[model samples]
Target: MGSPDPLEWDFSCPDWEQRLRDQRSLLPDLPLDEVEASRAVSIFDRLRLPDVPGQPAFADAAGDWARDMVRAIFGSLVDGERMVPELFELVPKKNAKTTNGAAIMVVALLMNLRPRAEFVLVGPTQEIADLAFQQASGIIDADPDGYLQKRFQVQEHVKTIVDRTNNARLKVKTFDLKVATGAKPAGVLIDELHLMAGMPHAARVIGQLRGGMIANPEAFLIFITTQSDEPPAGAFKAELDYARAVRDGRIPQGRVLPMLYEFPEAMQIAEEKPWRDPACWPMVLPNLGRSITVDRLKKEFRAAREKGEAEERRWASQHLNIEIGLALHSDRWIGADLWPRAVDVTLSYAELIARSEVIVAGIDGGGLDDLMGLGLIGRCRETKNWLGWGHAWAQPEVFDKRKEIAARLQDFADEGDLTVCEDPTEDIRGLADIIEELNTLGLLPAENAVGLDPQGVGALIDELSGRGIAEAQMIGIAQGFRLSSAVWGLERKLKDGTFVHAPQALMNWCVGNAKTEQRGNAVLITKQTAGKAKIDPLIAMFNAVSLMGRNPVAEGDNNGGLDRYLERLSA
Candidate 1:
């Protein structure tokens, strides 16, 4: 089969309204205990809105959609099956997600009925955890008759609300895996889960939270968050993809119900960019006019646009609930816009070698502090697309030196896109062997195809020469403005959908990190201008693209000269 569709990269729930309607239709066939659902809604509705002026009851503050959603989540039941064990809710910011989360936990605590049942509310940071705790505490304090106070012991110091009746307790904590390791939670509310996307151990922590759910069928785990300003990756991307898949009816037996507030696929892919129109903003902002106003958003957007392109992209991502990749800077590599569309995970290294008539390799690296990057670019004979694969290696010492990006590095390591070498020399030898192996297989260019940064490649050149790769094959590529044509050529391939790459997180991160600097008539992408981010792999790709552009291979020519060279080598 061909590669998976590039559109799958966008995990936005475009058909959310139809998904909700389908869910509502299933309620009748679900054997739902309306009485239990009604009771849960009633308990939740009794809680007061702490943010409101006079602390109005939740029922009064909640909109119709909120009340119905809460009912479906807590009250729905089946005879011998769990209605929904997980809930993924995505909404824009300023929608009172925290307040609603607090109320949901309160209702869960009231309805537990199980002795010593534990309900946990987790936040990405301590401040957010404390904010949730405060919201719940405020609701408890606002009860005029001391109903909540009399029924539960509010311990602000410990961040717990203990139910006097069943000894059940509700607690709030940050995303510390150590804290969640052994706890048997009856329900978990993960607030702002998008923030924990890059937390290397997020999957492990979530597994621990759901570990006890198999025993407690009534257990529910709810992930509530605003869309992240950066591209989704790691645990967040996994969960969001699964949620979207389940919502779209692709996974018939999934136990997760997704309620995502965003633009539909048609609007998202529209030629006129309807999503940018203010008239369509309210379609995604369900809590508009209540928590946030259109006028406020318009004012903020106006100011953001004036600030710069990156700022405006961030504003749209956060305010309009758009899921997008990073907005590095105004003069970012033109390829940045097309990279997302070039992802094709089905293009494995073996598949590339098997299909390509000839391949060109690029090597870019420095000392232990920098990443050692290798890129392979080839013309596939079958589809005729320019397929590419990239790998990067870093020393363990980088983790300590670049502490700010430690988690991100760990994430890339976990995804197998990055190699953490104990000895920097091992990276040089390993990359050399990889290129040598591909060259021995008769897939690589016969000569003058392997591009390397002119400087800092003495060891690599020596290694490749030792492996029978001639010095003539190792061409030195110039850096800076000299490589502007290669950069522009790669951007053209990406935009034309002729450039394809195997899904590699480190490569994507490197591509996103690249920012261009205009040097006279030529534009240059440099690590110096990209701040602390690493763009070594992308630089390597640019070097390889320059060599590929020089080759005399015609597009869609199955009997190209490279194919004859490969055939003669095999003979």
Candidate 2:
């Protein structure tokens, strides 16, 4: 069927009018206050749109979707207290997200009954914060009747607007702890919340922001954001996932009202990718015919596609609200496109051991500031397929040095795929312990069971020697073009449907980050080419692949030895 009109229905949602109906009279969810909503609308009606063609007031410029968002934000109030604590709206870019957010905050400021209270607009960066200030100040400045101008004080340098009558201030700030620290606010508008997801202390900052609201019964939080340019991680992922759950009615509602703009789940999973169709573009674009048009977006999308896969992915993520999946970029590894197809999510450590006849390991990159990656490749007992798993370890210095990927690394840590160690002594010991466990089960080959890069592996060698791993059990794998066979072999195995890996975010990220090239007669993926994207774990996987190709047998013929020794170790 075709999309519903924005004036009558929520076009993006597959459920359509169900959520709005539920919010009206559902128990634990009180009815939306039309009086308070009208009050909020009056505030919006006063705010003029300066840059638009007609210079219409917000009441005229806002579509039903915008009005619905405004009503849900304000109509949750009964008397002077807020019924809903938070409202989350996710929309695509070029929809005036910044301007809409500014208008909402201004209405919030005007509706505040608390004296000397604070209304804050928080942006993830300084530039975003400045833009918010300009839009909000412009709204007041554009008032020809001196209505808002006479009641509020706009301080350009400080980026603050103070209500002259009530002594309340609306402050615009870049993401800072001080915004959430020690201060209680009547209302807060978190602009572009997705951008804050990558901050090192995203959870803590959000917690603090919410924590401050405990004191004010009338407090409200409005989060307006666009789809992230990269894969969502950290706080962004958590909130976005929660919003989806709430919007889908999988989670109970009333406390949080989510207005998510994106393709319906069914259409999103369609075989042909319905979101890619120009006809389906309007499904997610609620601002259609106003802030943006299908033709303009189609033109931009065509340009992005012509540039390369990477550019296209970024554009689709921002515009169509499509979550970025695996890289699958042309310049990426040979197996990049095939990696997702070869996932066996049930492949855990115990599962690997239970299914494998023999297992080989690869270790790479043990620098203090670098991530030390370990890959385990196992030959299946019956299927004869290869099962893969990976783990990574890093020190505190990694977080400080690689701040850009720190949030993602922290996410990996939370999933138990990566460990952050403080003591260097305990770090190598952890890897050694895993190697020792596999050897104890007699699952490892008698010779050359473990493959490691020879460079910067002196410490690992010492630890392994202490655990009684002889030199032959741990062979040094050559790097760069020399290991091309394993590189090509892994791709062939994945494509031939003989090799599959545990569905792991760490491996997915590393695989996506990998860049490959043909060097003379050999295909190679080097750390130098991968740069800061960190493909150490993938290199380690290749090292394991190199040894697995040898087809060596376990010490005890891989018999009843595994269950016996592993149970005893647990005891």
Candidate 3:
């Protein structure tokens, strides 16, 4: 790949309203079977809702929003066949996604022309699968008339619903490779696809399911999910991104139609934050008058805000369809909460050096399976504000050891925040070269400018020492509670919008992974507290903050002495 762009684009859809209209438009002109579509909607409407107040049928309890979504998903058929083989529906929580999946699968069974066909209902776990099966069975049991009972049989022990006459069976199973090994299902419904995204076999399982669906030409697969609580990753991210592109008209819809319940980019990123306004909550909450209520959601949102920033974010992501970009862990460093706001993508490594009176650095060591992080903090020559840049290096083993985050690591690599080195010594040499170049520049302070963790500083020190960088330039930043001042100081800078960093996804991930603990009145952030999630880059930044917090000044020629050290870097 070529050099990554130093300028980060804050993309907001200016034609969001038009795009939204196109996405949710009913395909009325398709070669659809009007009778079958009407019949399917009728069947869906007759399905009983036992849990809802008054135990009304779906027609009585469901709002127009749900009825439309159900119609768009299940009833649209071309030449008596399903129009789209696959549909992705990303809705907020409490929209009855699972129940809707069940209802549509029942409609598919009733209207299906194929005999002895298979239908699949998949969930991320057995517990989730069981709950979906319960909903399916409950809908069946709620029918006061004997028609549905005589027409179909629901076996609770096996979590199977069978159509008696057609011998078509719908089997509920957790998402697993073995689930789709041999079956050719007439229709498949996947509930909470976001949860299954993290599964190692999610892609393979989905591939197998798609293959199974291909065996039945008229079959359809529906994926119903809510936004992930955390930043999107893995198979979920892939599909979500693709679906969004299609919804935005960046790509042809082809066989997949995405019905995503999300705020327009303008509302989501607007300075006013209209998404957070209680009056605008109904825009995303399709079930506002039915299963969901505006006042109830407002009350819950207020309670979540009182809990903590993390809880508030979680509540927003779940109920308001607000995308989560920050740390949701209650113990996450406070700096992480404001990290997005402090993003100055225009701040590059060269820009940081060019605009700074002095620049200090930090280094954090990691094992073969982890990243070596370098963070630079430059105090702006004019504004006196600290501008930060971060980079991480990792051995190839990181992919093997942390396979779950390998995709995200590759994303960081693409974004130029990380480098995957062929050799461990190569990473050290890279760090030493950047430091040597910094020292040659006038911005790096002559003494106590580089703060490093002492645990594994030998290799870097040896390389830098050979280059004539004095040992006095490197100071060991105390870990744990002792570095509390730097930790707190960085938070203050970020909160007041002074500490600016090159908006890197790597930094965001590290910030989200970071967890802070109060130790004897000091806030301590440690890798040990972050569990397996890598926070080396963030730790290194705090280390740099510790050194910069001392207000060191460079003695070298500030303008012309050193060559561009960062032009070699991708960013």
TM-score for each of the candidates = 0.83, 0.90, 0.83
RMSD (Cα, Å) for all candidates, in order, is 6.4, 5.4, 6.4
Global lDDT of each candidate: 0.77, 0.81, 0.79
Candidate 2 versus the native: TM-score? 0.90
Name the candidate that leads on lDDT: 2
Model 1 CA deviation exceeding 4 Å by range: 1-29, 76-83, 212-217, 269-271, 338-358, 379-388, 394-430, 441-443, 488-506, 518-524, 552-571
Candidates ranked, most accurate by lDDT first: 2, 3, 1
Per-residue lDDT over 442-551 for candidate 2, one digit per residue giving the tens place of the 0 to 100 score? 89988999999999888889999888787889999999899899999999999999999998989998999889888899877987778777888899999999999999
Give the alpha carbon lDDT tens digit for every residue of 1-571 in model 3: 1332212111223354554444443222233345666777888899988567666888876655555555655555554455566777778898777887777777777878788999999998888898888888888888889788899999878889899998999898988888888978888888898886556667777888888877676788888888988777767777888777766667644456676778876677565677778877766766667788888888898899899778987888888778777655877788876788888969887788778878899999678988899999999978899999999998989888887777677767867888899865888988888888788876788899889998878878888899868878988988888889988999999988778998787888899999988888898889899988899989999999999988798978776643454444544
Give model 3's TM-score versus the native structure: 0.83
lDDT of 1 by residue, 1-571 (tens): 1332323222234446664434322121233457887898888778888767988887777654566557766665454234667888887888788888988899888877679999999989999999999998888988877899899999989999999999999989989767577788888999998888767678778888888666676788999888887777657777887887876778755757777776665665454656777877876676667778899898998999898767877787778877765545677887887787788869867666667877888888876778888888988877778999988888977776775566677777877878889775889888988887766666666566689999978888888889988776789999989999999999999999899998877787888789888889999888787878788888899889988887734222334534554576589
- Clashing residue pairs in candidate 3 are none
